[model samples]
Target chain A: MSLESVVAQSHVIVCCGSGGVGKTTTAAVIALHAALQGRKTVVVTIDPARRLADALGLDGLTNEPAQIPGLPEGSGEMWAMMLDTKATFDGLVRRYAADSNQTEQILENSFYRNISTSLSGTQEYMASEKLYELAIESDYDLVVVDTPPTRNALDFLEAPRRLAKFLDHRIYKVLMLPTRGIVKAVNVAAQTLLRSISKVVGTEVIADAIAFFGAFEGMEQGFKERAAEVDSLLSQPDTAFILIASPHADTMAEAQFFAARLRELKITVRALIINRMQPSFGDNHSPEDLAERYAGTPLGEQYQCLAEAQHLARGEQKHLLGLAQELAPAPVVQVPVQAFEVSNMATLQMLGQAMFDTDVTSEP
Target chain B: MDPKQFLTTSGVIIVAGKGGVGKTAVSAALAMASSSVGLRTLIVEVEGKSGLASLFNSAQFSYSEIQLVEPSLGVGEVRARTVLPEDALLDYLKDHGLKRISGRLVSTGALDVVATAVPGISDILVLGKIKQLERSREFDLIIVDAPAAGHAITFLRSASGLEDAVKVGPINSQAKDVLALLNDPTRCRVLLVTSPEETPVNELIETAYSLEDEVGVSLGPVVVNGVLPELPGLQANPLEAAAQAGVELQPSEAQNLADAALFRLQRTALQRAQLDRMAQELPLPQLLLPYVFTSELGPDGLAQLSNGLLAKIRDLPDPSRS
Candidate 1:
């Protein structure tokens, strides 16, 4: 498939792999290629390496969409944002709330803000909702996302369902412990637990939780509905997931495991980009020939280093082939190891070239 | 360095310290040495830095157990990869080549990425992988180039996060197995690496207490990198002379001599003060690495570091013996 073909067809490109495998860089390159092809693209990176800025030659960026410079002004625009987990969570709460008053109450309530933003996996839910909004709005022709490195990276893909389940659950209403009159003997289990917690902690923290739940009482379904909408948008044909990995066994295993999970989940596995790949000079020199030629040679030391490097490269290539065999056998691109580290856009463009500039169909 | 002493009951050795304190370099050196001695070793990190890769001169590495070097050594760099529920099912099927007949099952929600993108998710997976590596016994040593001080506790504490999320199931069972390995003192140890700077020193001390209090991981040795050695036999005399000469010295040859002496005095004083502070704060034994100013810490440099620091560590009697 040509770069244009993938860009034109794939709607959602999800980059995943082991950390330090250049997932963020790969995402930026694909997005940039899409934009250059006259498709509006937005790249959202969850990588803290902040290499996305380097890929775009941007010094820094905020959570909001910032237009990348140096691309032709009118042809296509590439907008990038580093995912700010907390701010995104806050934004989601505000955006999905029924009205300004409810939004204000949720925002002002410490318990709501803490559980919504600081609680583990909250950011993942927000990121899911945010992407769903962008995908549905059709503001960009394509959206490229960089996922957090976690075993849950696969589970993260299931976040909308989990969030929706929690939103739809009756636990919050039960936790509210609505005060009943003296005539009716209501279930005081929640009230007793709240008082017990206060006694143990010497504070009325449970009161804060109750207040937060009260504000969120009526609008929980709104959140659940958005979660449902997102759940549907993710599996659409327009969406494609790119599995990024390095030429390491552990990374390949992760890619394979992720690919397997994707198969199980039914996400479109579009293509695999093996980042920071080592180049194989090929097996033109047999081991016996290499040994005999270097036996009495004056360049023995240099030969040894070259032979060792060649050996390492071959090992990496073997591992990459194994991953390909394990996956869907789509277009596999290998980005050769650069002499210099990727710290700026020039290098990233070279990386993009390594990824997108290849003869598209040559499977690794 | 004595490999025997190093591998005594091989478990997990997490190297943590302030950012840029040579923790990565030290972890790589230790892992390399461990592997050289016929021990299966794995090094892990959260940030996708190929700090260890550059040392080994390898370009591609992974998050699962892939050997970057020959024989017994491996490295896993855990970067998050999202598989939407539907897509995950499809990926599973496609690996089985099920995409040919049934491809409609893929879930397209962005929720997977959104939910897993939380701050501690990376930390949780990172530590979980490290814990997994530690348990395999495929490697005698599991060296973790842990995140900087601020997040080290959370990285280790991610076990709790996973446990909370998975109340019951195979994932919960896996979490239990990993947590068992983590809590075993013989199976794991946390090594704090620090420089002789104020911020890193304070952070190291704070991290030590937090990890102990929050995660219950015992703090190991504090490896102080880039430590300046004292000028032998050139101590109080020069400093006293400088202090006595309150009258500013003129720009002369003697002034340069006095200035060099004063520089040595100041550095020695600073080094002593740093060691003293660490002594008061941390109960663990401290290891010191001499300053090497060059930017690159390649293979040869790493070997040299392993030899030098391990030699110093060997020379010191174990506090247990004392």
Candidate 2:
């Protein structure tokens, strides 16, 4: 019902939207608001844009929590970190391995490193794992996450299950099966095929892969089960998924898709923050008059340009208003796009206030 | 254009970088440039952002490409990935007579199960479509206003990966065609757009190396947009520093002092330092664009940016000419 209410109950707050729509800023603002309300908060961002650090006034931050400066200096603190997907994956393997030797074997494997860094769903898995770790650590009352601009935005939703399945698949079990003795014709045939493949590829990468999988024999089910639990934690109602989008048709469409997906996954989308929205002045004569006056001059041409922007702003506002009307169950907050970028904390706070206006959704 | 010089078999020019770094803007510009040279070009935007629509001042551009600059350039917004997902590809396939039977195949845990079981199934479909567009003989170049850096790298790499995973059928052959286009340096050029920011710079460098190593596609160059102009008279020297200290600055000299102070020399210096770091870290030559303080980038403004780009292009030997 209220921003505070959601903050108090929600363990995981996932930010979803198209790129350049200020989803990261919304996540940071929500995290800041929670911390300000006497709840320990950590905003974890996977956006490659690095906007959270800028919004929080940090030069840069690593994967671990870095305490932010000048946050009113109180009992409830705010910390931020950028998710380094590769590092997190490496850390997980290192932690879960049977021994240091096993860990080294996996790390040195080409397949593992490639899958950890460049794979599509890997970041989403890492993000979920990171959130699960944060939830387990209980250092913070809430963890706000900014997801990467994915194709379906479902990867964030599907990540835990996907990883769990990948770890627990029959292929995984087959790969991990120890080859203590190989008297069978099938083993000999496979070995010959592997040798031919190695010669063609100019590397023994397959052998390296098999060795890495061998080290994970006893640890497979543990990782899979952990992934399943993490997935449950994410889909629970306590983990609020906040959908952020602009007022543009494209952004609104994205919001719709995300909303439907969230509904399917049974994740409660408690609120929607429409960022960079154009505020409606209600019967403003400035745009028309200005456009007419500057009709001939370059400044007039400039006004012509501003006219579309003004119109789009008005349209977006109307669209958001329509969305709020359509999705009446969920509270939608509209933060008008400023003339300049929302780069500073002062501006972010202002936006937070605009977005969480008490008048919009009265607290229960 | 010399075919021998063309590094790529298909000219699939993908414009990608960090959001707000003007990837769409550069994509439109590159499309216009290619089309103006009499090469038929189609610029496809998957997210339906319609940044290209706004640039072209069109009311609406749909899945059906609308001609922007008659006989040459065109732009269109396909179904945004979020809305359709695999359905977008399904629609494309259905239009090509692949049919609902195929959809049923994908859903029944038979075709779908097999596809899903394959390591890079989605990559095959998503990239197979884009690669098909690239290979279309109707256009000389297909400019894709791709997703931002994180996803774009994965999208580009999908071609070769699918080729390896689907090593035997028509899909594998299609993957080979796409891979040939992508791996050929001349036919396909990957342009990265950035605004002289640290994160974008670092990401761009990371993307360049990743593409080079993983996919064998050389990153063209870094297009540094929104660079500040050097105002000679307003330059901060020892004289200006002394003036700021209140000794050299008088009422008569106040204009220059205020001017120097207000122009954000410190921020500009820091931005330049970041740019310098980019030049050092990235092997690709950088194209620096002058910053426009104006609210909107209209046609004239875009033309100015394009002119600056053209001059930069002239300095480098045209691969086609070479």
Candidate 3:
């Protein structure tokens, strides 16, 4: 199916790509198109561009989706939300906690307070958790996700599994026992492990950790089950993944890697959207010929400009051909580099038109 | 300080930026520029996937330092190595002569525990290794290719955060030493990298302020990579300009030429506007590297970029004067 169909029909669309490749912009454009097609849509971004936030009329930090003002006429409705990782983590704690006291225990624990934000997997995992919350709990027709900008974008997919692994680790189990005051189960090896860790990080860290784990008790099953549900939700027919990329070799490489990884995970990339591609000059003539034809004149310099621009465009096309070959049969949409930054709603609409090869933006 | 002093002023120059902004490439250029001035430079790569080794025409760097550029007449050497928390922890254990515990630590997966249980332990481990390298003075300059901007803030601040979190232990002392090195301008400084684009420029301003107000890391010149070069005769119409130049162009040719000309002109204008805003919002010396349009993005491209960076570095005003 076409990318427009993905926007029209899918319940969830995940935009995965590296940073500085306009991944967030692509997500926004897609969401805008979905709204223009009269489908209720919400685009969630980890860090919203200041201008985008302004255009959305978002005054400050918002925990829920806010309706986008002044969408092109006939657009169903568009909403934007800024993902607050900390607030989402706290929500999980409240959801899984057996009682509010358990919830307070986890929230008030200094170690949890410190690691909940800085935790290696927490940021990525929290993004998925938020996605699950919006997809399963919200009423929007489509949920567009701009995945967090991690060096390895696959971290978002593997994060739940990694956290689950940590939860089930024997060492983690050992740490939990001490908080429960199970002296009988603390083997000599476990004792040595605790002492060794304390020698390196001091006893207070160990104490804080035990307390945090104790507070986390009875919450693991709920988290594990939710993770399983999210995992299933991702691979379901209702969900779609679009891989965003650029002409730069580094980004192209990242895109290829992401596609391959998704394949390993049994997820198919619906479409490949390459943003910021140089507009082709369509000059088939060689630079040698152009120079001879327009030598020693102002026109020669102008022709040189054309030649240089064409050279870059040709090179990018070559690189993208390899990407296309690697990702064979996946429809590739090439969007020219924007003349201005996509900081406003007008430019965003123009980009959406360019992606779909349509001119519905004529009214503006 | 002059360019040489601007570079040698601090033993450690941590290069960081948003991913896909050529953070790793900037790190390579800085190393090449430093070595050009007869300074022995070593680059510490934290992201094993950084492809920094390839920039120097070498294989992937492991824990063992690989000499990428050998010393020559009037030029120093360039060497690099990758530092993971696992390797650094093993080295730390071996340094203290606890070799047996080291093997068991890995075998029992206690290292992962240490990293998870102690927030920022991995970053501190990596930074601690850089500290050790700085103390040895084996290299006149050390450039760390730090993580991307988002993680970079947390990475650089890890030591200080841990210092406050853990008050008395080996981890605490390590945190203190790393924080000291970061805070001392003469010992280390951070160089924020960015492209002349809106989102990156905005992020750079925020990152620069965060590093100063939060991490207390000394800031150096902002290396603005990927600046588009000014196209000649941008204002003149291609058809009109050709007619004036005593040359006639076909309609299609003129169209293609105008398309390219407009593209280049708009890009250069945007570059200027973004740089102007950056100057107003964040007043740091800017080192402009032209946007690369090369088909060959290997050693040759890296050399060209390095030369441009070195030229810009030489033009920076003396910090003491500021």
Q: For residues B188-251, could you state the per-residue lDDT of candidate 3 as single tens digits? A: 9999999998888988999999999999999988999888877566567878988887777788
Report how closely model 3 matches the true complex, as a DockQ value: 0.56
Q: Tens digits of per-residue lDDT for model 1 on B1-322?
A: 3544655444878888754567778887677666656666666655543356666776644543455666633432222112122332233334433344332222322122222322243345445556655556656677777765555676678666667754664335545766776677788888888877554676778788888877777666788886755544333242333334332323342233344344445655766777899899788778788754233466776777766566666766654666
What lDDT score belongs to each candidate, Candidate 1 first? 0.61, 0.63, 0.81
lDDT of 3 by residue, A132-226 (tens): 99999989899998898877889889888777665545665775566667884555676676676667666776777767776776678888898
* Model 2: lDDT of residue B43: 71
Q: Model 3: residues >4 Å from true position, as ranges?
A: A175-186, A288-297, A358-364, B1-3, B93-109, B318-322
Over 4 Å off in model 2, which ranges?
A: A48-51, A54-59, A73-75, A98-101, A172-203, A284-290, A297-306, A340-347, A358-364, B1-12, B20-38, B42-139, B151-188, B193-322
Order of models, best TM-score first: 3, 2, 1
TM-scores for every candidate against the unseen true structure: 0.60, 0.65, 0.93
The number of clashing residue pairs in each candidate reads 52, 7, 0
Which prediction has the highest TM-score against the true structure?
3
TM-score of chain B of each: 0.75, 0.77, 0.95
Best-to-worst lDDT order: 3, 2, 1
Q: How accurate locally is residue A342 in candidate 1, as Cα lDDT from 0 to 100? A: 52
lDDT of 1: 0.61
